[model samples]
Target: MKRIYKISVAIVTLLAGCSKSGLLDKDTKDSIDAQKFFNTATDLQVYTNGFYEMLPTYTLYTDEDSKSDNLIPLSVDARVKGARIVPPTNASTKWVWDDLRSINFFLENYQKCTDDAAKLKYGGIARFFRAYFYYEKVKTYGDVPFYNKVLSANDPDLYKGRDSRKLVMDSVLADINYAVANIPKEVKLNEITKYTALLLKARICLFEGTFRKYHSLGDHEKFLTEAAAAANELIASNAYKLFTTGGAATAYRELFARNDQDATETILARDYNTTYGRQSVGYLMTAPTAGVYGIPKDMIDSYLMKDGTRFTDQPGYQTKGFYDEMQNRDPRLTQTTAGPDFSVYKETTREPVNLSITTSGYRVIKGLPSRDQWGSLNSYNDIVIYRFAEALLVLAEAKAELGTLTQTDLDNSINKLRARAGMPNLNLAAANASPDPYLEYWYPNVDQGLNKGVILEIRRERRIELFNEGIRWDDLMRWKEGKKLEKPMVGMYFPGLGAFDFNNDGKTDVFLRTDNTTPAPAGTTSIINVNQKRLTNSTSGNFNPMYSTPCTFDEKKDYYYPVPTEDITLNPNLAQSPNW
Candidate 1:
């Protein structure tokens, strides 16, 4: 049975009493007899199973990517549109600590178990989750109040001020270190293992390291060194590798489309099986009436040509149509988005780009499963949490930022991904000798002396390889490139605006016009009103779905979200974020 099913209703009822208002307010201890519950390995395992709820579900995979430059959704997010406001209470703030309270509650009483092995195992899992919880808090609102023990409502520490980033991160590091040292070195796809803890360590350290370096916070080298070391250990373990059995054409897409998580590459995943419950990933990615998220041109432009050359280097690339642009690019591009030749199955029927489904013409097909699964709560694909490919990227980026990267590092890290995509190897010397001006324009703040160019390439690789895995926003935040959100997001291009062939099958795939009365041209599969759909230029140019939405990024105030006014009012020492 799946670990998710093992969580009992009794445990759920116990954890449900945690209050969301004050940090660590509700004490569930009075409700349950901890002495009886914390007595055996099975008991500890059952209690710890609740911690898995903290992991992300399929919603994050489909929704969070829209907040980044990778996809344009039906509606612009308030954060992306510069419309976010400080909340009156903790309602809108991500400041809830109920999960932490439960984790800490378990930690405080788990020692009653007498089983040393189970105690250490479950204890490590609790600490790992605590580290994961704090990492998210730190990423959203820096300098959060760190708590290891479950606090009573009237505890003095409940009203204390926020801890320093350095102090809190150091504590998080300690927790993760404990988790790594104690967790069993076993391969469990649905359960957290030692390697999963290591991945979390590498992820958080890399975020902190780059955030410090870009935001001018001090002590970045310590975190970068730790990040590189963690990633190195994971890679040296040889426990996982990139999923390449599907080869170039299907390897990347198959990673997400399959129902089962490929254990060879996926270290940890959120289990979604038919017996448990299904998700809406297939419906959200393919339904014509509801699927509004679309891959943007900026992300589409990031894919390198098949021969390892930059796609932007080609002449007249900007004005190229959908069919033309799809030609000779990375195989992942066609696998991820709707091209002229895209089909859901091996049958002869082709899936044309549906304008109604995607705000941008570039419909995303990365996570969509078979046609039979495109119904509400019908898909059973597991959502990946940690994979070996990310470990490799983390190691390479950490080394590059630390100015310790070499050609060997590229061959092991970025080159492996490139090879999976059927692209040539990334030559460190060539990259450093002449950086892609296109990537440099996106990340002008990357100034690592001779390693600057290679760093830019690594960033590009990270973006392309991990496009919709819910990490793009954090990447932008840590790099201090929030302003990129303000740029106009566009899709496929059109020279004039009339009937156009999306698949290059000698038949009109779509018709674009400003007038609503005129009938669509014959053989057109879809008709789009440019006035409603929008274009960068009045009559022609790239499809600009969000042209009317005003997007602004205030570098001073936007990086970290403001704390709730109510929380600050309750405890005056709990200061609001800067420039809120």
Candidate 2:
């Protein structure tokens, strides 16, 4: 499939985009003076916005929904059961290159500023933005170019290369350190800050060090230990506090809806609205009738109960239909997902709300605006880029990787997340259940009982806390658990519903997933297996050999998205990730 976007950034003549400096028009060397642009507040504001302009590329890394759904399969929540991505071509990779290049470009000239505060503030923001880009790159591709200054076309060793992932990590960590030391402690709701930089450092270090150690990267434990140390320091600082509310919906639904409320969890957010740019996660997830997006029925199954039972696992779970399935579970589920009974809207005197229950029976609420947000003035919500929940989860992952986490460790990390959602704290010792079974499922390769089930607990918190924030893909990757299912996509079928009987035939709905399959009555293209006697993919669309049902229980390699085609071309030196 053709990649869908290109950078609108202007390429100044006489300059070349540098590997380290990124995609600056490069006129800084012998052409336009960098000082001219950095001299005024107006210039500084406009210049600062250039970094924000590239934010769209970061989220656009997904591909077509079907017909070789590549990045999107991983980008969106399509690969849980067994979805696959199309091949990566040149166009798709350029975006990553351009995104990184934009930040490098900004930082290259940002230093030329004569004003001290502007230099620190603007430079801090630039470094933080650059670090953010590399963090994304590192998460997806392990190593990358670490350019900090403008490089000229004639510079020798133009071919002399990408630093090791470790080296890149050093660069990322250093920039974050610099940012924390320079920017203001209290940047306005609309701006980046010193605390933002430090918080970002906590996130990246935690993610990088934790993920590597979890996957057994070189010096794995060393990285994780350092990452955990970094996270704990942030926790100890108490510069930010958890967003807490007493109302039933105040726990999480409040933070999810109020984008800019500084709950201490949010590290940085991509601002969205009708005017400044908007988030259509709702439009993309809810059906057309909902004026937003809709979550498929398969995804809704991933939610676990307060007692940690899957809806399907609970006795008599299927009878109550979705309302009961959704009830008494995490309250965040209702806030994140819309059920048939949901009737929320702006207010009276407003046009009729055009929401539907969705063909799959779910709606997108998290990151969506109230009906009144449309038109005129922009919706002032911050698209959460980082939240404290991640810090806790990262720490949990780091501790688990170290295999040194304790009951108390799990309590503070994952259990606290569960408590936030009103679920019982996970207890490994209380019920006399050894964490061994969970660990065997998780770190089967690790020696006898070192993992101790902390990984699963970490995942549980993430699943409940980070839903609909575009985090699942990254999640499946770092955990290395996105592709366990053979058939990733499948249709949804109730026990006996939606079965089509052609010619008014009575017996036409049976299907199976093995060779020598049999087709049922007319119009029913299916067969029955000795194991499953009920309906199959006849009328319900559940028999795709390729697609995996959302939560059919899985883990796999197609989890990491293909580095966009455009990114590859911009940095041919960089290679496609394995299994992409």
Candidate 3:
């Protein structure tokens, strides 16, 4: 609940432009305005069409996982490592009101249509976006001002202070509930529907519920119950399902790379086409040698064995080699990262010997494109935003945290995901008897109770299922587990930098020596630029690829961002978040 930044324009003076510069007004006769825009359902549709553009796509390649343990970038971010500073103004801040303004504009004008059904339908769409807009705001800054009306620059409400998070979330709940009731029941891959609204509602509720509970803010059950109810509604409807078009190993991989999104699982996705101006750089950004992206050794170790047993439980598990470590693990492990016999972009003929691309030796294969679609900065594959898999995880976690989860709940929610991954069902009693040490260390604040084991499992499932999808940072933040950032950002272990065959292709594919003048040894395909890449004790044996640098996480000051000084100066009613 930080007052992060001030709006550039003071609300009272926003509409003071003179007509000489056409600043006060342009010709509304030809241009779309509030009165002219919502006259017909077609007009309403066209106006709402802009809202879909606001939906996230992989094109915005700010992979937040880079800020967490899920993946490591070329360099550790100073901000994530307790080096952030408050900016002078809102200019450099991510906190923006334009998206809210757009949604509020539509909501204020969508009722011009006389047809009751059309009005309700379009209004549902507007409300859904409003809810989404506020959800992002509340999550990012907490206790943001809520507005249903499209405020003019001169509107008094523009200068109002921040509202309580509870009030804003209640408003969001109302909007989403209306959307679920009135949005069309018919499902579409790229468009929002009643089910999409339900999914968003569930996600929002689970986040707020968990956040309040972990932060010790009371009345958390209200949001937990809402989250559970929304997820249960979707489950009962049977309108959506986890995409299992192929076998377990390949199904998960295919879900991200398919030309079209799998309608069974994906409720709404941001679409792209070669001809369309909108294209995604996700593939290129994550491609080999594109950026120094790699998963941490800790994350790699979290994947369970094929039979749903913890890999860490295996004898000598920590000492296993790269290829050996990947064997017979969760099918998703092989799907998400390159494993033995892995090929480039699903092309069996193309061998994955590009060791230069992966810092951890665990190359990322999720969402990469085939040879045909592998242009430098082009990929038309849709980025899924809302999906049934996430809803299932939300249901399981929320129920577990509420302490009301039953074996039946596990059978319904977590079991389905495990089944899709070709793993066994989780046994509550067994998991408690031997909680995974890796997860317990990551979430050390959690109390050992009846729900502890199930909660840990749910967290693992959420991370593995949603890895690289931009959910980790928010999950950590809401759980008040930011201290995990201070943990070492370690990658695949190596005895020493030397020439070795990475893919076991019977050819030495990597020459990892530190000497720049040393030409790659015979048949080497990758070179480690020690000066450029991170490595723990680069000069010594037994090094980590990702933990070469030092970083820290300030438990108190780093949790919520601070409000800008200018904003607080402008409005004394505004207060900074705790400790900042």
Q: Which one is best on TM-score?
A: 1
TM-score-best of 1 and 3? 1
lDDT of each: 0.86, 0.52, 0.74
Instruction: Indicate the residue-level lDDT of 56 in model 2.
Output: 43
Clash pairs, model 1 backbone? 340-503
In candidate 2, how many Å is residue 408 off?
4.2
Local lDDT at 569 for model 2: 65
For residues 1-580, what per-residue lDDT tens digits would candidate 1 score against the true structure? 2433336646744853666574677666566778667899998888888888888888777688888788888887888888889998887568888778888888988999989999989899999999999999999999999888988777899889999999999999999999999999988888889999999999999999999999999899999999999999999999888899779988898898887886799998888878888989888887776658888888889899998899999998888888888899899998888778888843458875577888888888887788888898898888887899999899999999999998998888889989888999999989999999888878878865999889999999998888889999999999999999887788888888788888777888899889887787677778888888888887899888888788999998999898988888988888899899
Whole-structure CA lDDT of model 1: 0.86
- Kindly report which residue stretches of model 1 are placed more than 4 angstroms away from their true locations once superposed: 1-6, 9-16, 20-22, 345-348
Q: Residue 509: error of model 1 in Å?
A: 0.5
Question: Residue-pair clashes per candidate, as listed?
Answer: 1, 46, 1
| Candidate number with greatest lDDT | 1
lDDT of 2: 0.52
